[model samples]
Target: MENRLLQILVCPVCKGTLRHDREHQELICPADRLAFPVRDGVPVMLPGEARTLEQAPEQ
Candidate 1:
């Protein structure tokens, strides 16, 4: 993804900043613990489309 696009992208659930996971091609929302998929160069910001993050693994 382009730097310009990443700057304006935010988590739809928490309205928080997203971290780009280049390897996985997803946008990570820390506060909401969701990973929004970026398919075909477009971000899917819908909550239903997001993947739930396991909290225990990071701790």
Candidate 2:
């Protein structure tokens, strides 16, 4: 994801900053423990589209 976009993108649920998980191509909202998917270089910021952190398998 572009640094400029990353800087401006915030979790829709918590309005908190997100950490980029490059390997998973996801924007991780630590405050909400949700992972927003990034597909084709676009962030899917919708809350309904996000997956809970607990759902992700350990890497």
> In model 1, where do residues sit more than 4 Å from their true spots?
55-59
TM-score against truth, every candidate: 0.86, 0.91
Model 1 per-residue lDDT tens digits across residues 1-59: 99999899889988899999887788899998898888899999999988877732221
What is the RMSD of candidate 1? 4.1
**lDDT per residue, candidate 2, 31-58, as tens digits?**
9999998889999999998999999634
Model 1's alpha-carbon lDDT is 0.85
lDDT of each: 0.85, 0.90
Clashing pairs in 1: none
**Poorest stretch of ten by lDDT in candidate 2:** 50-59
Residue 3's lDDT in candidate 2: 95
How displaced is residue 38 in candidate 2, in Å?
0.3
